[model samples]
Target: MMSWSHHLIITPILLPMATAALLLLIDERNRTTKALISLVSILLLAMNAVVLFRIESGPNDFENVYLLGNWAAPFGIVLVIDGLSALMLLLASLLAVASHVFALARWHAVGAHYHSLFQLLLVGVNGAFLTGDLFNLFVFFEVMLAASYGLLLHGTGTLRVKAGMHYIAVNLVAALFFLIGVSLIYGTAGTLNMADLALRMPQMEPDRLMLMEAGAGVLGVAFLIKVGMWPLCFWLPGAYSAASAPVAGMFAILSKVGIYVILRLTMLLFGSGPSAGFGADVLLFGGIATLVFGTIGVLASQALGRLAGYSVLVSSGTLLMVLGINDGIVSSGALLYLVSSTLTIGAFFMLIELVERGQDAGANVLAVTMEAYGDGEEHDMAEGEGVTMPGTMAILGVCFAACGILLSGLPPLSGFIAKFAMLSAMMGTGSIGTTPGAAVWTLIVLVIFSGIAALIAMTRAGIRTFWGSLEGTVPRVLVVEVVPVMFLLSLTLLLTIEAGPVMRYMDATIRTLANPAAYIDAVRNAVVIEGWGPGTGAKAGGSL
Candidate 1:
């Protein structure tokens, strides 16, 4: 029998896969049953993720790496769990639980097979996080993209279909790029396993190293596109804005998948190897440009949906820039920001739909009127009467303010804590010549500017939605819908309350990622059955 320790590494992937398959066989009419199954499955996944996090935090062990079919490293598939993967697993599971519960309010019934697609998406994400090989990463990427395609078009609408089509087309091109890059890397390195590739990279010939670098560049482009890096991310805002609330909420984690891969590969293959500084300059500049663009987008957005979408871009850009900095202290802080920002953005997306339900009618009228006739005089957009719910406006206002505080890096929230940590790390580097470098200044300026932009945009949106008009209709938000939003926000508060432990964990995770010796050893030293091959007489899981 496999040890529970080994099982934990695979459960994040297998549990979701099994649940998704089972969900597929169930009838769509059985919504209650499906919701229960999805809820339970995700809860279990979350519990398992927490267990993994605790285990990874406690000890250094050999059982963290599991070789499928008892095949050796660089041969069979492997799933490795460490601090980063465990943390991602926990975050993803938390988001999944919140998104699924919120979907139960109404979005799940918006299309057939919603629960199945959701579970499959989780499977893909967890697999991507855990996979020890590049090829399996690609496989999981495809799985994730496939599920997202369906989720994006979940609700039948002209806008959703058009946006989904664009989303699909863009990703298909990215996927092709992914395949080409993978092919080149494999051809050059003669191995698809990440740890083995890292081991082999320094031994490569000059020409093959160039080829690998070229492949990495192509792969970087694909990941950058997914992460909404500027210029390549024209498709992101519209696609995200067009998606249903629950789908959009889940999508907050989707982009991070690309970011995760980049972080993983960069640290694993080039942290201290021959290609240590490869692509660092590109990441630095590209991230800066993306941040500028996202800030501009945030300032220009007129609708909450588009604004929320742009906020995602801003978050992506911030993380990308920090990664480019390549300092472990900054990276640890970025990880904290990553978790805080993702949860806030996901909650914001769900909240946007509810907040906009009442405003759509008036906004539509204003838009049509504006298109037909010019603004002849100064007119208050808030002149209309608003409908009031007893406590909805207050609750929504508070949540909206929380999101703003988090997104804008304001104080008394996790976002503030995260940004402060990052800023502190940058200033503490001690590498500055009496004056900070241009890059340091640029980062500091952009961080402050981005926060201000988010504050302005969120303030405008909240004012317009909650307090603008006294003549609007009360939005019919269900308790189920509101609970999930509160849950996500509460988690952010918890992150603030427990900032010390969380920051320490992030610091430890970054250290482990920076020093890949333990990771490499775990993979290299995993036990394998002798004569292991397809159809061979080697029984699985036996000692050599």
Candidate 2:
């Protein structure tokens, strides 16, 4: 009999997948039905998260694998949900719910197929988190990418279509590389199961180890391409900025998937030791370069959308750099920072869309400032024509300011806490006389300096756009506009309140990561199945 823990692992993925199917049969105009269905699925997924969290929090030591049709491991399809997978699933579910709520007001603007694609995207994300096999991860990647193709260009505008095409092209190439890498690993290891592969990797001959590392390196490149680190990140800002608001929020989760995979497989397969040189350096140096480059882009970008997009790049780089640090403390801090930065930045992106909507309603950002300054609407107008006022720019300004402080790493905000954790970890490492080399020190310096620069840019832009001068028209604000921003901000605050618990969770996860043998042991002892081929049999694939 399948365990209840297995059900928890499958529910989040299944809920969205099943919901997408049901939603497809419903009429496009039946917003009420569509919403109710979505809500139900979201609730179910949320419940699954709560259950999985409870399981992980217990002293029982959870690592449940569900085999489709009771076929057992190796040959059969499997879904493995461990602490890492559960945490990611919970985060993805929370974001999905928030994004769905935000879409309610904007759905009309987004047109048909919007909700469908969104659900499909969630399914892909959930499946990616749950799948225990390598090829299945690729399958989920394709599923998400196809939905993104539709969602990215939903409105069919020229700019959006062009950007979407570029996004699709780049990812398609990356996907192909991912496939090639997976094929190579399967051929060499003779098994595609992740846990099994992890158990077998360390025993491989030196030449075979080189071959495996090469394949893994190729796979890492594909993920790095997705994560928007340095050179591979060129397509991100323009593409994300051009996409719809909900799409942009979805993309926020998308980039993180790459890093999630890297963190997972790197620790699981390659072992979290100093010997993983090429991989570690690639992440470290590339991450530093990405941070500096993204900071420069953030400084130069004028549009709020583009700035938020670049901020994603910077955050990805920062997080990956922590991954490269290879220390439990640093990795733990990085994990915390990832959650903080994603929420903070995602909220900001949503807020930008709201601001743009308000501006479009004839209330200019400047009009909000003028209203506060007692300058008449006419005075705010550029010509003899009358300009309209938006009631919501002030609210948008406050949200923007909060996001700015969070992004810029100002005190008391959650962003500050994340960065402080990272810097403190790094300094602690240095103090232990391990002496992170000159390269690490250089990266540390550049990251700090670029952060300062990015802060200056955000301040200048926010002051000029929201508080500095009067503009022609103001955008009207709606409850829909404020709700998403509030939702994300509340999450940010929640992170602050439960810092101790969250940090402990991260540390526990880090400890698990630092010891891959525990994972291998769990899988090896879990079960033995009958009726599989020799290579795919119960025994672990040939040792690394």
Candidate 3:
């Protein structure tokens, strides 16, 4: 029997799967029941995530891997948990909780099976994070994409439908690439188990090695598309901007799924051996280009929704660039940045709907145009012109400012700390790591410029929405809706307050990732309980 502690590895996937199934059976008319069930399930998953993080956060480097059907890795399926996956698990669950609560305000009822699809999306995300098998990674990828398809079209509108269609088409092609890539890997390595594949890489013949890299390159393309890489990401802004608030907020973490896979595979398989630096230049340059594009979009966007969407690209590009650098110290900061940016953006996405609720159609565009060409005449003061800002407007303004500060990497926030950590580490100002002159400096400039662009864009939008529109009617916001935004923003605030401990945790995660031996050995040495078969129902436990 597996230890109860070890069983925690599968709960993130299992809990959501069960919740989604249960939710499906519940009548959609009883949406309150469905919502409560889904929310409670996610909240429990959040608790599970906390426990898993604590389990992995200790001094020990030994990771937990639960072998399926009482069979070991390189043969049977396994769910593995280490510091990174635990962190990601926590991030995903917490984001889900916030988005779900936000949806309950009204968005859930507008769509059919919203709760079910949402839970299924969680299943796919957690499964992808946990699985050690490459084939299952593809399975989870499809599951995630599939659920996302329904969620993207949840509150269907013409713009949303069009965006959803494009999203589906793009991901379908990417899925094909994912299949081809995985098949090639299995064909050459004779295993779909990631650890086993990593172990096999050193012994592969040169021809087989070349083929494997080709496969990995193809695989990278699929994830890059998901990561919203330039040229491949044209569909992203539209889809993201078109989705309803809660779904869009949840979608904030979707790109990170691709980043996680790329990091896991790149570091495990290609981080060393014959292909140590094989595809670094491509990702490095590609990441830079992506930042450039995302920044341009940020500055050029007049609509708040589209700006938030482009901001996702900026986040993806930053992480990819850091990963391409391949330094553990820099990666630690990137991890922090990932958490901060995701939470900030999630809050921003939810907040955008609330802020825009009171604005006139084309107000964003008109606001931008008026700024550029100037409104011809000044308006005479009306009777209520000097009225103070409403309580709701004040709250929204504060949240908006918090988001702007976080996204811009401004001072005293988690975003600033995360960016500072990465930059200092990259520049060799930190305790470890060194940077090259031209290329790294170029990346450094782009990173800084992206932050500045975010600042400019966010500031302009803020002025338009809060300052200029202060006299406008306050949008009717429910406590349920705004609290979720506050919840996400507050977490970022907590991240700032606890930066040292979080980064220390991040350091441990990067260390574990650096030592691929730890992961490979954990899988290889995992044992089934003695005298215990798959269905024996023994009360014993296996060593992890």
Candidate 4:
């Protein structure tokens, strides 16, 4: 009997895959058919997310396991869903749907295969979130990367091709390292099942444990590269800034995948110190450095695209710092901040690109402003042609302000609430009291510095582009672009207003991640016990 749990894992993947395949079958010139297929896929994925959340709300942290071919435990392929996965899954689906809608307006402008590549990329992202095995994670990473190559270089322009090469090269290196690390881990542990590995990791010898730690460290570096943290992030701004609006929005979710994997691996395999362990320090200092570097980049950049890129870098840093703190309060705060930031930042980037596109700009302000002015005076240019309207600038201002509030930790925004949660958590440890501890001081400095830097940078960008007098005539913006920006801003505000409920839910989810025993037990119990199975397989309650 097929269960909802099974569907939960399969639906996010199948819906997108089926959509992409159906899109392929449609004539390349049939834009209407392609758009309809995209909408249906998104609706189905959203429905599946609702079902998964309902399941997760039930007792046992909403765990569901689907074992391939009736096989069980360490022997068979498994797809498991728990609290963290559920939250990420829902977020991915939401972003995917929103981005797809934003892309519809651009379909006529971009090539016909754009929709196909987009759906394929979705398949890879959804698969990454759903897969239970490490090797499968690598496979999905490649799938997403391959599709992204097409999307990033969709137009075959000189600048985009240059950026795409750098992007691909960096990722290819990361993938190689990832494969090596996974191979090493498998050779030493004899099991690739995440649950089984977690259970057995505590029993490994000290030297063997060191080897595992090294492997994990290498893997961590690879993911950090993907996340574009500090030294590893040089390729991001150029590559992302060069893509079209919809492509940039899709790319926003890409880096988060690396962070998601880090969150998963840290809590699952490394949090409890799986051998000779150094707890979260690796994440702490590295995170702080990333925050500083990203903030500096944001401050220094003259282009809107690069600024957005750097802000993403800062967001990644903040997330890592929260993870590094490792306290329940910190974890909950980090998770909330991540959810809030990802949506806002993703929306913000797309909005900027739309504004730029309307103005015939490419990340450079003076050039864009000139182009807008020139278009206004063109003899052949129609009154509304190649020009932005007043309503669009108003919409852009609102979106920019919302992004600024969320990214800069301002009040009445989820970013502020989430940062407060982290501060509260850090203070709970007496680190920031009358007697200041080193950890407390560190947290204090990090939060204050990061907040100030981000605020200044975002404020400058917002003021210059939105409020400042247009040195030249402004271009007319389209309705298709403004609607999505407003929608995403609304989501940020909603998260801020409902912080209490959101935090409570996030806390429950973080607690589950912090302690995986419940997750393991749930999956273990869900297995149907059939007397004895062949070749290393056993019933739910039996030994392998």
- lDDT by candidate, in order shown: 0.87, 0.76, 0.89, 0.75
The C-alpha TM-scores of every prediction are 0.93, 0.89, 0.96, 0.89
Q: Answer with 3 or 4, whichever has the higher TM-score.
A: 3
- Per residue, candidate 2 scores C-alpha lDDT tens digits across 357-426 of 5344334444445546865434345576543335566677778878888788787777777777777767
* Candidate 3 structure quality by residue, lDDT tens digits, 1-544: 4446767888998998999888888888998999889989999999999998887787543348887777767788988888889999999999999999999999999989999999999999999999999899999999999999999999857999999999999999999999999988888888999989899999999999999988889888999999998879999999999999999999999999999999998888888889897678877888898899999999999899999999999999999898888888899999999999999999999999999996787777777787889889877899866657889989999999999999999999999999999888878786874545788888888999999999999998898887776337789999999999999999999999999999999998898898889888878877666676653333322223
Clashes of each: 8, 14, 0, 7
Candidate 1: Cα lDDT at 299: 90
Off by over 4 Å in 2: 3-5, 61-63, 272-275, 358-391, 429-436, 528-544
Number of the top-ranking candidate, with lDDT as the measure: 3
Clash list (residue pairs), candidate 3: none
lDDT, candidate 1, residue 297? 92
Largest TM-score belongs to which candidate? 3
Pairs that clash in candidate 4: 387-475, 387-476, 388-475, 388-476, 388-477, 389-476, 389-477
Superior candidate under TM-score, 1 versus 4 = 1
RMSD of 3: 2.1
Where's the lowest-lDDT run of ten residues in candidate 3?
535-544
- lDDT for residue 513 in candidate 3, whole number 0-100: 90
Q: Which residue pairs collide, candidate 1? A: 385-470, 385-471, 385-472, 386-469, 386-470, 386-471, 386-472, 387-472
